[model samples]
Target: MFLTNTLIVLATVAGMEAFAWLAHKYVMHGWGWGWHASHHAPRSGWFEANDLYALVFAALAIVLIALGTSGRWPLQWIGAGMTLYGALYFVAHDGLVHQRWPWRWVPRSGYLKRLYQAHRLHHAVHGREGCVSFGFLWAPSPTRLRAQLQAAQAQRRAQPRQAPPQRPPQADTRGR
Candidate 1:
């Protein structure tokens, strides 16, 4: 029973990547930008409004553990899964990509580099719109991402240049 529960929890944790991708694209970069925008903008302090989301998720895990411990449900395993996923997210998203922590060991041409490149592409867009690669665990090839960014840059350049409006030469009053 314990092993079964562990597997179930692990599956849920893995499945969370899909949920996370949707939430990041629709919620975090959407309406939730009110808080999440702090992440994209230059930092002013150690903490950010974006950190609130992590705190909220942590609180939820605590709640699940509390219930599971009380024998209310089999939520303990689920809670554990969430905790572990959070730790992994911190290491991958924060430590490896953002350099939030001091652990330094830059990867060269492998899954780690791919993940780093994908996330960098996600941030290529200055704002929330036009960003891609929302899934942290499942990243597209870095070559593809680079091509996409370059294509976008080219498209921007292709847009018609707007010439300044010429002043409708001085009216007839001047001629009169």
Candidate 2:
């Protein structure tokens, strides 16, 4: 039973990648852009409003741990998984890719390189919209993502353009 619980925790950690992907796409880029924008845009300082999302997730994990200790639910494992995943994300994203810290190592391996490039593609977008590679821990090959972005741009460009609204002719007031 203990092993089963551990398995569940591990599974939850893996699943958090997908959960993060969706949340980054919909919530962070959509409704939560007010905070998340600070991340995509140029840096003004060492921190960003986007860091609030981390705090929110940490608070949730604390709540879950408290409940689990109180015997209210089996949420401790889930919370632990989320915390571990968050740490991994911070290392990969903040430390390696974005270089928010002093860590300067670059990825030479295949998967790590893909992860790094995919994130570069994500930041290639000018704003929250029309962005790709939402998942921090996982992403498609950079070539594939680039093709998708190009395809989307082509589709938008191929669409018919709307004509400008015509203004009514003004009266000949100068003659009067």
Candidate 3:
């Protein structure tokens, strides 16, 4: 029973992870670009709009859990899988990959380096090269990822920064 449960959970997680990647590549970066823009903008904040994607996933988990608990085995497994995916994403993307929190050491592997490079490229200049690397936790090649990063950096350097708009001063109502 334990092994069966584990398999179900693993399969669910893998499927959800794939869906998450697709959503990011298409929805978030494509039609939803306006909502995702704050993530690419330079700002002084601890969190970015990219974080909202996690919330959406969490809400999905809640709905899945509801369906699963209501006598639906498939839905339950799907929920379990989504939760696992979210956990893995938090570890791999936020913890290990981005190092949002400090860790004493990180493992040096070609695979991990590749994932890092690919994600860095995604953040590079926001949407120049599409579909080179899309996985959240794993990457197949570091060399290709590095090339993508270099290209993104070059593209960013070639672009000029835009100035912010100034607002007109208003009358002081406090004096009245």
Candidate 4:
């Protein structure tokens, strides 16, 4: 039973990454841009409107855990996995990549560098469209991401020119 629960937790974590990639690309970058747009803009306070998505996911995990404790099988483990993913996302995405916190250790090499560079490439685009590297925990190679970005930029340039959308105030911290 313990092994089964562990497997469930691990599988859920992996599944969440795939789910997150889909949701980040379609929902967040698509119709949910109303909330997610705040993430791209320079944050004025300690929080952005995008943080609400995390709250929603956290609420789901809480509900799953409550239901599992009430005798529903496996949900507790699933919730545990979700909670773990959320914590990792907070640390890697919010803390390390975006530098939303005061801890300022930049990764000079290895997977950390790839993760950082991939995310930064994601933000290289000005608006919602043409962004790359939607996943948080798992990222593609930085070289591949840059090539994709370049292709996207070239495609956009090839299209008929229109007045650009009203862009938000870009933060100066993108290079870091």
The candidate maximizing TM-score is 4
Each model's C-alpha lDDT? 0.83, 0.88, 0.73, 0.94
Candidate 2 collision pairs: none
Estimate, for each residue in 1-176, the C-alpha lDDT of model 4 and write its tens digit: 99999999999999999999999999999999999999999999899999999999999999999999999988999999999899999999999999999879889999999999999999998899999999999999999999999888888789998898998988898677
What is the total number of backbone clashes in candidate 4? 0
Supply candidate 1's per-residue lDDT for 75: 85
Task: Give the residue spans of candidate 4 off by over 4 A.
Answer: 162-176
Cα shift from native, residue 36, model 1 (Å): 1.1
lDDT of 2 by residue, 1-176 (tens): 69977886788789989999999999999999999999988887889999999999989988887887788656888888888888999998998899899658889888888999999999988888788899988879899999988987898799999999999998898876
Q: Using TM-score as the measure, what is the rank order of every candidate, best first?
A: 4, 2, 1, 3
Clashing pairs in 3: none
Candidate 1, clashing residue pairs?
Answer: none
TM-score of model 4 relative to the true fold?
A: 0.90
Per-residue lDDT of candidate 3, residues 72-143 (tens digit): 776777788888889988887887666776674365666666677667666655552443566787564767
Worst 10 residues of 3 by lDDT: 124-133
Error of 3 at 18 (Å): 1.8
lDDT tens digits by residue: candidate 1, 1-176: 87898896897689777778888999999999999898888877677898898898889888998898899667877787778878888888878987777577667888998998899889888988778788877799978888888888788899999999998866677555
Better of 1 and 3 by lDDT: 1
